[model samples]
Target chain A: MFKGKFVDNLPKIYGLYTGGFLLFFLAMMVAEKNGVSAKMIGILFLTFTIAIYALIGVLSRTMNVSEYYVSGREVPTVFNGMATAADWMSGASFVAMAGGIYYGGYTYMAFLVGWTGGYVLVSTLLAPYLRKFGCYTVPDFIGTRYGGNFARFCAVLVLVLASFTYVTAQINATGTIASRALGIPFGTGVWVGLISILLCSMLGGMRAVTWTQVAQYIVLIIAYLLPIFWISWRGDFGLFPHFTLGHEVARIVELEAQYGLVKNSAEAIKAAGVPAGLAYINVPHAAAPEGAMAAWKFISLAICMMVGTASLPHILMRYFTTPNVTSARRSVAWSLFFIFLLYFSAPMLATLSKIQLMDPNLKTSIIGKPIDQVMAIEWVKNWISVKQAFIADFNKDGILQLNEWFMRGDVVVLATPEVAGLPYVVSGLVAAGGMAAAMSTADGLILAMANALSHDVYYKMVDPKADVRKRLLVARLLLIVIGVAAAYIAAMRLTSILGAVAWAFDFAMSGLFFPLVLGVWWKRATKEGAIAGMLAGLISGTWYLIYVGPAFMAKTPWLGIDHLRFGIIGATVSLVAMVVVSLATKEPDAATQKMVDDIRIPSGKTVISHR
Target chain B: MATSKHEAHWNDTKGLMRITLALWFFFSIVIFMFGYQLNSVKVPLLGYPLSYYMCAQGSLAAFVILIFWSSGKQQEIDMKHGVSDAERTED
Candidate 1:
């Protein structure tokens, strides 16, 4: 029998959530106006928002295996889509995506296109069939479909590697946001993020995360939109942010070119008196290469990101929570729409922030001014004092030249409201949104890695007949262990946030995407083929990255592909290996073909029995 | 007769899928291959560059429409061939 919809009484839940958030927002506003210090206000905002998420996690906690693993497969369509959207849009998408565009110009649009295009592949190639298969985890699908423990174990290894990288980046973003908001050291922020992430995921498993993600979507969307809406409405763009922002982007490009030319000239470099290597600080905005080989890097990046999007285990795991195949298919559309709202606005916000940065007021003359005088301007002084953004005054000309300024891209969105002279509360709200984005993603990643370990590796391989109670307990313990490990790595700051995310996506795409696709669509695909292909992809992808990643970042391309996108080559190898090996070996048996046929149907019936 | 007919219908649906996926490949790849070139050309009325618009909003809209289209069409194909789950429930 079908279960009753959880959101059927959505009105009550909606009223409570909306009313509670409003009450909290008003309290913060009042407290700030009553002369609460900015640091205290920010701490209150971050603490309150994360606390609400934790409370939601506790309320939705469950011990039942079915509920813990996949939320009992009862989440309705609309809510599932919202949860999926929140899971898909990690801290990187919410906080750093626009900042990427701000820093890298047109080349960075690859993230938007590649990430969004990924959902199309998901709905078409993966979701419905996976839903019909009624598996609890990605590795469940792999193990059952391939009819071997080796394939399942391979999936677990790939899932852990990919999701761990992703979760670390989210934890790192959390650290940065929490540090800025609470005025604490970065190390402490990582611990705070780790505790909060474990709290949301360890107690209830997927059941807790599903509803908390819905709550997070609300917080993140509101927080993301408010400042953009403010900036758009205040600026000449009127109410719609994306409407007139094309012109703003064009203007930003123009200014970049002007500054770029000036920075590159001998006179300007001599005026700055910096080292020759450091003379060119402004990267040209329109550096899309015309050469075929160079352009291949862009194409490779786009493809890797797209395939990686569909390959992510945490994302695929969310589709398993939907009620039926029909709903699973519909849910992908909903996820796309919800994600579009933020992604569409990100570029517009990026352009607007750039315009504000280049405004006459903020770009004050520091030339000929003493160091103290140069540091007096509020934005300049704050950034320079913290060394977050710097002004070297290399010429000691006392005037701030464009080439003399350097600001990190990650600060663009966080500093936008400040640059626009918005109220201090807006910055606090942005910080909360950033936290929600990072925490929501962290919750999903930790849960996926835990489920893979407990279900695929431990339950299936180690203790095949373990009771649900034992399995669930093991899962919760694994969640806590993984959370601490990822947090420890995040605190070390081994890689930049965006760079780490790129690695995670590329690894998943290379190792998992093709195998999963071929496993479903190709009847000729054998168990040996799947296993060999996966191992080949993972080893080749990681090896290439380790060997050539740094040089690729320095603008040297390996075989016309950036090191970040070497996954494309790895995926090609995977595809070819699967086909060649599957042909060399015998086809999958008739029963396996029958299983594939059974899964391809949109029937509500579960063909496979409970593990 | 009925089983063989079902086999024929499944094959036909598979054919339709190939066509649809080909279109998706074109949009995801061919469009991206020319992304820079496309971006250089602006849409007159929209005042947005083609590549920028496509990456930002156009492809998303296409994806939403494509999923619904494929899902709906696949359902119709199943129903017409007496292969839908609803047919089983009726039995």
Candidate 2:
């Protein structure tokens, strides 16, 4: 079943991956032990990545063009799915998502809903249609459908904007991972991330990225799952046998009371290195309305997440890799299955960690320790390495107070190994996995950016006479430039991995989702309509986020608006614009009508016969 | 457009779409209601809040169920309508 020419190349890719992983791990170990700064190790890693990527570029000069671009399109479905999974995971999926859940409580589950549900829409609605059109890029589909150079240019604009925004987020996440795990300066980490992007994208286009992403996906999932399982085993050896019962309310309530927890003890428990317990008791100091509005906000966030996942550009492109429509559908299903494997466990682990932290005994032990000191003593020192300690005595009373900063959201995945007290090796593996997730996504976004520049703009729009070889050359050159540009942007702007990712998703939902969905499903959707809708969505959504979302939500009461609500408003505006403009414009001609007809009909002759 | 033999099958496909949409609506409502009721349920699993557990785990399980049921039903409907590739070839 695994037989393929690419399988022969597996050993080579594995060798490179493992070697790179080991080198980074050993360097980290030495730095942790010898009092070498994390910043130094990060700089070293960055320098090493750049050198390796450059070497690959020199070697690729001898390689054929097809092999560089799509790996001859001979990849097996299962392996392709794994690579696609890696691409989908991103730095945000590996680190930020878990952290968000750990910090935001049940509200963060919106991401899981949006992300997974989007796949269903892809498989059932969009994937098969796009695959049938047989395009190399997303812009290709738009160009062919609209049959105009202007249409192609608009597609390119959307593609680049979406991709550059996304690439910046990936690089930002890489910086966070490097700075936190290796103790590198964030700026230096950005430089390293840029070099890794250059190395991966500059060598062989889709061909190289696909195989590398598969390898990366395996590493990321293993890294994410292993520590959680290890911690679960350590925390309660009988936890598994009693998983069903242990997850129930009475047992949890009993555990909370046994732990002597106060109500709304999320912050306190996290500081104490105990899992959060659900104590129904009231904390008189609990902030905000403790009722329906809170629940409505949660629901609204979920809606935003579900809609946003469908609009992400890099994720949409994976459907193009398969041979035909059926494979695309099947591939999406497989992607969901692979994603569900980790997604289902994430919340459980978060809850369990929360409960462990809230235990009264652990709380007492943590009372006098500085927040950082507590984290170092209970988590970092025991599991990874305790390089230094910074404990804050906030209360002024001989005891140190534990607050929200001790449990920053981004720490969920990184702290998993430490929370469970797994071996140093596990922590090392998680780091590699996080890098893989970040790099795979970075590679995809860079490729999309390159394609938009070289194919859509240069070849298709600016000069239709551009030769194939020239187009290919431009694509490669653009890939390098975009990678560097994205890294620079990431270094200069943005903070926190998850924050950047959330902004990217919000942008996609607001600007792209409504236009794309309507363009496909609604016949009256004119090109003018689509263009106006995109612009309106981008402008209004951004304005609301910048001016309204934070200001009113933070300072004023009953405004009842946030980032998620901004997305909904943006989508609504886009829909209204599309409908109004379409009504005022002429209908599509016969040829355009034919294309729509073909999209709806599935009863045609087989395009790719198995026999 | 000329009427083709496939015209008869269109209704079936439309019916399938209706059913799928209905299933989506039904499950969404059920899951939401179930989530609301979870607050009252006292049962726990693995030291987690049971209500929270239902919100995270149980709702996801329902989503998976909705996917399978809807897709499988669509396939069956296609077969019955003689529109499926396998069914057409058999005929």
Candidate 3:
């Protein structure tokens, strides 16, 4: 009577997981009641959740190449959707995005639109077609379609550059979060997290990674929603914060009026008969570009992110797991929907966190208070002790004035529960969720880069006679090497977590966007043209970024185009190169044109293969 | 496969692509063109500046709907041209 299939048993398994999670939540609360210290609670969360992930990794370990490289290419639409969502919402999105909106306000919304809107491109322009191609890695597609080893090598080089930048950003987030939870220094925390990252992905391969990501997504989505639900309910903002959140936003605008923080911090408070005070305790880097420049940056960043989303190798790779082209399209839709659940609530989370810290009615309010008294608040005491926030009476006015008080934007999401007077258990949950976000993203990126290098460069180019086992071994070695290098770079704290991530998106879009798009849609695109585009875009973009910004320590942005939006320059130049070169050179043969035509069609057996 | 049949289906798919791009551009770009000015114009019911509300909340929801809708619509176009995977599986 109980001869149920594995797919039928899936719901039962996840149901049991949810029940176990609830019990753990209660156990933590009970342990706190029994006088367990908050530090132990945080430590318990860090170890417990990661232990579960590690266990999944260990259990899913495989030696099979099909299972390792692409999960045997049979993942259902829904699970792939969940895994893709988990893959997409990295530490930057789950933790830092709301904080970005909290401090940067409206302009940062570009990230939300750019990120989610990119799915439209994915379903229409890329994902479904990639599934039809049926390649193991992106460069595999470039090699076969563009008709040369040199073109494929260029694709791998671009993929490594983009994915490596992205992995470092994810590692930076994981390290910061590990330090916070373990009570270790940031540098130590990063290394500790790096060991766990390697342990998790090194054994599992692709199929196991896919399932582990789904489990992580569940923990992550729950960890994300509870604080927002509680905050909105406490603030009397109704259950649907999306609709009622404007009430809180209206208050923030009024608060901004009182502070006069930005030149465009909405209308002045004097118009509403409120006195404008010195805007102490304000966003330090809140100088938004003025008028026309603001609009330009907003559109440019959104365009860059959207293009990058379509071009990101890891995200595109997820589609190859879907059983067929139709599911690939459906998977993109569901992935966007799952991601929407968080991006939709970010503004409310940002507003709620901001209001809690500043509103006089809330007990957590700190600005305009006596410096010593503010320090005595338990949340302040906890965070300040950990160095997430700081305050001092620098002017000797005995008050924590604006510049004298500072908090990292990274602290906004993690500390919101404490800032709202919730139990310590909630903070632990948020940390687990943030760590999962970082881990899942880092896993995908490290694996994508390693797979491309080993499959495309090592096996296909360096040693075509290598067997599947040898190729898999080389991939594992590449994983360790890439993971270690990324961890070291991340420890340097090159930039804010969000800034680094945005630059990665810019890099991916700049180097790969035109070639991939035109190769599929425009059959005339040739090997030489693709090579020219990738080199011109990648080289020009990287040079412009370091020349104008902090990574290589230079200054002076041309036309006020900051380093983060360097994709605008790189992609534009790349498109021109590809078009001009393709027109000037020989058109591809009929066989290659027919290959492109087959990719565009929805109904097809796999047109290309990689082993 | 008939060459004319492939060309005909491509034309239909291209129409759907145009519609998707138009909406994507609207929600992500056009609405935010006059962002600073829109900050002064609050949504009467929601009480957020029109630009801020659209950027943070509305555009995301629109994106979710747009993708699902386009996916479903594309399937119909595929079925019409006899190019869908479902048709292949049945054969």
Candidate 4:
């Protein structure tokens, strides 16, 4: 029954994807040899992305609703895992997360916890249950489960709020990558990202998005892992042998003795240059606080991450495309397994790079001038020509001072290849991967947004009798409009990739996590209760994040009491509100109770029947 | 016949859910405690800070182990409940 005209386009789709991938690789190779500026490489990458989208257009006709949403439920679990991984990774994971580890120390492990922890919630709680309900959107789950249109409406509002905010951050990352790598204006880079997202999303719908995301995941993972492998190899070999030995460790101690204090402070040494023989293991004064307070914030952030992973709208929707509940569970296990392969390597990469920045000899070689002449030198000229500019002199003291640039966590992933003196081709691949991560996630969120707008809101809620074809058209239109809106918002605000992405987690944990979890687990949970919980979560979470979060809690706090703690607090309030309200209000009728019962147990009856 | 089959299926699902939930809760606590302990204490291993090592590397390895252990337990529960997909296919 699900098979349709679009399914026949598979061969042509394969051809287009392969051709585009090859062409991009070839173009990048040529650019690298010609000594193209980083800016030119970025422009060429954007052009290549556009060409790929055009190729997708040639293979498939204009998308209808079914094709654009859920890929008509035709995706295999393994392939879906790849697509979901791309969705899950995003530009933040691809580019900024490693940098976060570099600057934040082990504290940044919270990101991994948040991302991977969410899958556990999805697999055990949401994915299989939602699939059983046979719904296309999250609101569909709400509407069907509660037997009321209002619940669906609230679900749609929450989905849009979370997803649009999330997509804006991704677009922001794309703009940053393009401007820094290609030398284009941030606005143009954003446009480039927007055009790529629109073309990939609007043309084939979920089918195009699914395949493109799969390709993007491959590019992003390879781009992320290759540099780490190269750096590790170089470190192990004589190229950077001190990195492997305890030489840097010994030198750090020696420098402490000579300078009277550990000279690892980036700000203090910025103008003076890194003293010779001790560039590694320099802990800045700002970061060197000891005790429970440090541990408390780190642990709190990790809890937020663990809970937030499950609540993300784009990540949860991928489960709907799976063939069965069991498959959905399996896919999640695989996703986490794949995610770990890269997640573990991130800290290692950060540590290695930090060591390189601190190494005294590398600093001196790249610093170029004596300490006295260093003040007259411009920062850009010193490292632009040097092979290891990321580790070069910042203070002009002929010593390398690792301060401002090193503090920016986003550079860890971008600078890895250059840090190890790998080829420019590696950088190009990383760029492509970064683009892929952003596009894959953006496509998923845009698809969910379009579905919520067209399917749940306009059709089911507003006009139940609307023609299917017209509904499909509206869905397509909504995809384009939402994509453009996200691009516009991204262009205006949401500066850092990690910061913007983290805000989405905080929002989702606060708003949806309680409603979704309570709605699924507790039978007594009434519509009024659900609504109350959701509103409390949304208003409180948003307020704390916008007002209290930045003011009071900069990071995760101890004893469940930071900005991130608000999500748990909001979630707890939601649960209590739901229970209290449910008991206070009239119970749902027998039919609603039976519906809840059906989802709770697996009937021995076959999920599918022949005859 | 349909009623009997349905009842059996319901029983199997109940059993599986109970097992899965138990395992999930147990693991969640175990992993969380391990992470907490790692953060609170400092026992060095292999020239690196012990607590730092566990939070970064140890917890992840433990998680992978948990997945495998849970999968095995799931297989056992499926068998005991006569709900294994292979068994159903044979029927």
Highest lDDT among the candidates is held by which one? 3
2 versus 3: better TM-score goes to: 3
Estimate, for each residue in A372-410, the C-alpha lDDT of model 2 and write its tens digit. Answer: 555556664533233222233334454433232244444
Steric clash pairs (candidate 1):
A366-A398, A366-A399, A366-A400, A367-A398, A367-A399, A367-A400, A368-A397, A368-A398, A368-A399, A369-A398
- Residues forming the 10-long window of minimal summed lDDT in candidate 3 chain A: A271-280
Query: Among all windows of ten consecutive residues in candidate 1 chain A, which has the lowest summed lDDT?
Result: A272-281
Off by over 4 Å in 1: A1-5, A261-281, A284-289, A361-374, A394-397, A551-556, B5-9, B82-91
Q: Count clashing pairs, candidate 2.
A: 25
TM-score of chain B of each: 0.83, 0.55, 0.85, 0.51
On residues B1-76, what C-alpha lDDT tens digit does candidate 3 reach at each position? 3399889988989899999999999988887787777767778888777788778888888988999999999899
Candidate 3 clashes: the total is: 1
**Which digits, one per residue and each the tens of the lDDT, describe model 4 over residues A1-611?**
23555435545654566566666777777878888775567667656655665455445444455455666566666677777888888888877776666555555665665566556656666775665555777777776666578777877887888787788988887776766566678888887778778777776767777777766766677677767777767665234321242333334334434433333455655554533322222342112235556555655566667677777777877876665555555667767676766676666666666556444555422222344443333432433333223343444455533332223355557655765676667777788778878878888888888988888899887887887678877888898888888888888864555656676776777767767776667767788878777777878777666554665445544364665456766666766777788789888877776666555443233222211
The ten-residue window of minimal lDDT in model 4 chain B covers B82-91
Classified by CAPRI criteria, candidate 2 counts as acceptable
Sorting all predicted structures by DockQ, with the top scorer first, yields: 3, 1, 2, 4
How does each model score on lDDT? Answer: 0.78, 0.60, 0.82, 0.63
lDDT by residue (A46-93, candidate 3, tens digit) is 788888888878877888887788887767788889889999999999
* lDDT winner between candidates 3 and 4: 3
What proportion of the true contacts does each candidate reproduce? 0.32, 0.15, 0.65, 0.09
Best by TM-score: 3
Interface RMSD, in order shown: 3.7, 5.6, 3.1, 6.0
Q: Model 4 chain A — which ten-residue stretch has the worst lDDT?
A: A602-611
Enumerate the candidates' DockQ scores in order.
Answer: 0.39, 0.25, 0.57, 0.23
